[model samples]
Target: MKYNNPVIKGFHPDPSVCKVGEDFYLVTSSFEYFPGIPIFHSRDLVNWEQIGHVLTRESQLPLKRVHSYTTSQGIYAPTIRHHDGRFYVIAMNVSNHKTFYVWSDQPNGPWSEPIIVEGLAGFDPSLFFDKDGKVYLTAGAFPGFGPEGIIQAELDIESGQLITESKFIWKGTGGSSPEGPHLYKINDWYYLLVAEGGTEYGHMVTVARSKNPYGPFESNPHNPILSNRSTKLPIQATGHADIVQACDGSWWSVFLGFRPVKSTKVHHLGRETNLAPVEWSEDNWPIIGNNGRAEIQHNGKSLPLGEPIPWQGKEEFDDESLTSVWNFYRNPQKGSWSLTIKQGSLTLYGQSSTLNDYESPAFVGRRQQHFNCEISTLMEFSPKEEGEEAGLTVFMNENHHYEVAKTMKQGKSIILFRRCVGSLWKVENETEYDESIVVFTIKATETDFTFSYTKTNGELEVIGSGETSLLSTQVAGGFTGLYFGLYATGNGKVSTSPAHFEYFHYLPGDE
Candidate 1:
């Protein structure tokens, strides 16, 4: 069954779908986004409910190296499967190539602690269970260090242990860097579907088949079964797909692509999810998309009626801990941030002096949905000493971001739009808004971003507004969301005071 609109959207990439009876569960990669690998549940492949996240506790994965100024490493794509009544997920912490697995009895799970698989370095790890109940793991093979192709290894079904040495299966049929393999058994042939083109403009989907799981395979004649190479549209990149048969026996494919916003060609949202249908030809070869190219239109069906989970937006800083919607760029500090409804706002303690610092400064932000949007926050800020500032920001990386901050100059308060230069907060633009309270708003229209600040005296000033075509993962180079957040930082040896943020709202499609 084809969906008029896909069930999954946003930065949800590398979708792995599993069906247990009539219910279906899907998981996607969360690189730097905390609460990694958001798991979604659906009955009709159209409507999806975020059942839970696979990694909630920090102990399951560490972020010391991942959250650093020198490097950006986070968990990459993951594959989820259900075997014998137990649910399993195989994932790779891309910063380090070690693979790990987690298990749960229920799809909406109180999942088990991660059991690190015996392996070195690799990405895009997936698990395959054959008809004989034998398990195998498939991953992207890296060369210069080892092999240059897709590699597979036997896994113990009961212990989730590696049983056989990793072996190379196929080098790809003249395609560069073949990876992202999803193993499937159709009829009597074992099919391996892979994504090639190096996650860039040349990205495509191809397949190979073998009679035995451990032998040489024949490449599909209709290789690159789906791609956007023919389109002149802004959406250039596409690939990294997984397929599954609906309970009604219809086939569907989920993959990743990007929709560029004018000058903001650097997509802060990373790669987005795309959907298409798969049809088998007379010779048993698979053809994807109705016209040999992915449809530009949304193809997911409407979800069945249920008491839907509320659409996520507008976070109240009432609870003592951070909400699920909030995640730190690197590692979070113990008392850097908190939520206190009784205090009437969210309090963020100052940490790093600038955005590029490795210490996870008091930052709480959400995903940018890759379109027009308005994000606003109200705050009462108190600087610890001189040079201290607190404000709202749109962050892509430490070096690439813009913020409106209230800072103490001499004995007076001033507002500024600042960008980061290592430890220094360079004042790109500023205005003399000597007020204790302020309302800051950022309006993003497609690729352009504008900043507005209003003082308590009703004086509204435009601090710094310009085209932000610099927030793309291709440009900024991280697997994190383009963040709109509330943050604070102290200068020297100083006593810190909490910056109270009243509300943070993202009005998507704002005119």
Candidate 2:
């Protein structure tokens, strides 16, 4: 069977996979988002379903605020491994520079609270359980381990402490930031895999092997076995991979890569999760992806393809809480948004904080999954004050964003098209509207994003447009992508009015 490169699309990056019995479970990094570490379940290597998140409680993952200087810095690379009868996940929070691990009985879980690991001035931590029941923790070099290289320490899993001495293993084949290490005992040999070249366009996966778990490991003859750097491949920045052997004894890898827009190095959809087959036959050394490169389409063996998961393009706000697809910035304040107050409509109360504020604003959104997609929403709001505005926004961060809103200007309701690009903040256009409710639409393409609204006569009228390049990672300098948001804010003062969002529609170009 054939499957697309990004089996799981959008901002789900730094994918790590593990298999238990007939099922394969995957986990990815969620930076600055409320519930961190999204976990997925797939029977076959192709079809995947989002089971739940590993960090559901704020106590486990406290994101008070994001680095204003950095874009995506909450949760970093996570490695999920299944041992004994429980599932374990170990990852780091770059915001605090701390590594922690969690475990649960079920894949979709109310997992245990975090167990913070001490003294690992590094990131991207992984757990390797040997056949003798001993677990080793490996990651990027820290304090005593010296420079950029891989480090290993015997982890006292029961206490989240390193029982054995931490030491430097193999400083990779001279790559910029060697990180994201995963150890696997394959075919009686200990295999150590790590990503290097610093994630950007130069990201790559390299491997080494050792006779023992902690050793003078030998580098693969084919060093940097998997990389798409300096290539014209659609899937660029290919690295940060985890290999999992299927129940059928076949090996596969799940990694993170991004598809740039319009043949350029400007991506706003963020790094997505992709899959590729791993060959491990002749030399004991592994061959990942396709000749050290990932493709847009992969033709591999299928495992009785499971039922596809339903898309959440249309949401009617019928449930008491937001769906799993929905996410909030940082830590949303209580009473900011509600679905119970107004049945079938999402009610958003405008807070004093705006999207530009460092603290959490009254905003809720989902990742802009597709480069070419249409987004539409119906909202009823009458701003009592000038700063009180509510509508749809294409958000990357506080500094880089574009919004088409319904706001009060000079005692009259008006439509607004605003863009925030770095230091420049400007309102491109605004028009007077007599109605309390208006339907807003945003159509996105590879080059630009066009804004539109419904007229009083039910006709669609174009508002304004923004360049998609302005929001790309190259221009904006962030680790994340865009989010289509439903928001209400008072700029700096609390609003007396509320905004009612009736429904939301997100249609991919193909859909």
Candidate 3:
């Protein structure tokens, strides 16, 4: 059976994976969102289960800068490597400007606290363990103007320190900003894989090889072994790859790419994880995808298809805790949300901070995995005063988001459809509704997002609509995707009434 691209979808970017025997574990960069570094497990590579996050406690991830409009400046590129039965995840927190790592005996686990890599001065840090028990740290300078090239250093794995001087390895094939480096020893030759040309439309994967782990590496003869630049392919920004030799002895690569809106260069769903087959060249270099390019649907070698992951869109609040897919904007405020208080519903106490504020409001969201999707939530909220609101939102950053909320305006309970794009904010529509409970729905198309709500008569009424491009990275200028979520806010005062959401049902159009 053939496999599809983006084996994992929606906002998951910079994928680094490792195979632990027949089971594969992968981790992606989680910027600004708490419970950072989401870990996944898969036995057949095609089916993945989100086991948990790498950082669960605030002590391990001190992210004070999270509750703000600081942008996508938290955790950057992450590389997950397994060595000698221990799993290590190395990443750079841009907010702290520190390259640190956390280790665990199991992939989904109670990982150890953060251990800062002293003297490892660069972003996109990756760990490579050689056969001789020597550990090497390779990374690219921060994502900036000039290409400082990839740097390498001998690392003390246990002490979390750099034992050797940081040396500049290959400058890349003259690509600007060569980063996301992962080094591997294949067939007695040290192969270094990296993403270059920035993470935009020009993104690409290039390789170099050296007989020694660190030395004057020779660039691949073809160079840029993988890229989709200048092509009108649906999958763009394809780079930042990690190759693995599967149990069947076949090589495959996991990378990041984005699906633009139909006939448009806007990708509001963010970069997603994609898979491609890999083959070795006659010259010993690696070949990725279809001659250095991947497709949305790939017809590679047929393997035993794994069990299908059942698609259940209805989200019930029956669990004692939220599942692995739910994430907050940052560190959620204490007492802002509770699942125990409402029994079969989620209770969110509205905070004074709004979604437009530089602080955390009561918001819970999951990634918009499909471009064509529908989200509906049954919310019961009685607005006690003006500015107190609870409803659904399509969010990107503080500057860009769309909301269909139930609030009190001019002492009248009403349904409000507001859009926040850049510095401009507008209430596109509002309808007076006397009911305290209503069902809200957001229908996302490739071109537009439709907002609607149910009236007291149980009939749905369209309130407003928005262009999908407005929330895209091209127009919004951030490293994140769209999130359709439930939020509660008092605008500037603590809400007197808590919003109880019975359930959130999401139906993706892709299926």
Candidate 4:
């Protein structure tokens, strides 16, 4: 069987995986997006289903005023591991400077409240369970301006405390930004894997091993066991990997990589999860892919293919609660939005006036999974004030976004096309429409985004178009992907009324 790369697509970066019985569970970084660390399940390594989020409640993962800094300064990398009949997820909150762990009996369920790991420094924390009932924690430590190296410490899982002094381990294969470290005990040696050369075109995965868990480690002679840097492959920046052995005794790896359109360098969908086969050499060293490069198609003896679970398309907003696909900008304020307040509609009370501010507005969105897709929503908003606006937005970050909103101007309802890149704001297009209800739409292709709307005349009219490259990480300079969803704001003043969205439909190219 041949499986495609990027088993999970769109902005889900820093993938970590662990297997239990016949089930394989995975997690990825969410960075400033509320309900962080999306949890996924798969019987075969190819097909994945998002079961739930690891950080669901504000208490478990707080994002208070996170947008005040930058969109990339929230949750960094999360590592999920299953041990002793319990599942554990450990992650770092860069904005809040906290390292915490949450556990549950099952992957999708009532996860335990966060237990802050005191005295642990650095980012990209991972857990390694030894065979003798001992657990260890490792991460990248930056004590100075030099190479950020890997660190190790014994962790008392029951109390979430360090039982020993932290030790600095290998600094990787001398690549820049050596981070995302994971430890594995194979045979009689402990192998440490780390992603180096940053998370861009130079990204690579390197490994080291030692007989003792904390000792003089040796770097792999054939270093950078996995990478696609400087190659013409469509998938680039391949690193930040986690390995797991299947129930059938086969080794596989899931890592983060981005797919730029052929002959182009811009990729707006961000880092996604890609899987590749791991072949162990005679010396017991793991070789990833052929010649250390991942491929779009992998052929091997894999778990049987199964039907894919449906996700993110045509939401009617009639459910009692927001579905797992919808995520807020930051930690949403209590009662800021509700579905039951207006039956069959999602009512979003406007908070902030603009999207560029460091405030969490009434916004609910899902990741833009594909470059070519159509997203639209029917919004009914009657702004009594001048700055109140509500409609659809393609958001990259607080400083970068495009919105097609209905705002009040000169005591009349007007549809406006606003684009904000950095500190610049351009109202590229606007038209006066007397209709109170409108359907806002955005047709996005690989390189462009077309904005349109339907008013009282019941005809779709094009408003404005923008280059999709403006939303790419290369242009926007963020670690997140694009989010297309509903947004309402008062520009700073409180909105007299809320914006109600009847439905949100996202049709991918294949669909």
Q: Alpha carbon lDDT of residue 6, candidate 1?
A: 31
- What lDDT would each prediction earn against the true structure? 0.74, 0.87, 0.88, 0.87
* Best candidate, lDDT: 3
Question: What TM-score would you give candidate 1 relative to the actual structure?
Answer: 0.91
User: TM-score per candidate, in order?
Assistant: 0.91, 0.97, 0.97, 0.97
Q: Note each model's CA RMSD in angstroms.
A: 3.0, 1.6, 1.7, 1.5
Model 3, span 408-502: residue lDDT tens: 98999999899999999999999899898899999998888999999768899999999989999999987989998899999898888999999
Per-prediction backbone clash count: 13, 0, 0, 4
Q: Per-residue lDDT of 375-458 in model 4, one digit per residue for the tens? A: 988988888888888889999998889999999887888999989887888999998887778998899888889999997678
Ten-residue segment with the worst summed lDDT in candidate 1?
298-307
Model 4, stretches more than 4 Å misplaced?
66-69, 143-147
Q: What 10-residue stretch in candidate 2 is worst by lDDT? A: 64-73
Angstrom error at residue 39, model 4: 0.4
Q: Candidate 2 on 1-511: residue-level lDDT in tens?
A: 7778798989989999998888889999998887788899888978788877888888888887545567677888889998888999999987777799999989898899999999766678999998888999999886354677988888988899888777788899888889899999877789999999988999999999988888789999888889999889899999999998887777888999999986677888899999988887488899987888899987777556566677779998988878778888877788898898889999999888888877888998989988789999999898888878999999998889999999888888899999999999999999988789899999999889999999657988898999999999888886787899999998887788899999999998851
Worst 10 residues of 3 by lDDT: 61-70
Q: How much is the lDDT of residue 403 in candidate 2? A: 96
Task: Report the number of backbone clashes for model 4.
Answer: 4
Candidate 3 matches the true fold with a TM-score of 0.97
CA shift of 216, model 3, Å: 0.9
Q: Give the clashing residue pairs of candidate 4, or none.
A: 352-491, 353-490, 353-491, 353-492
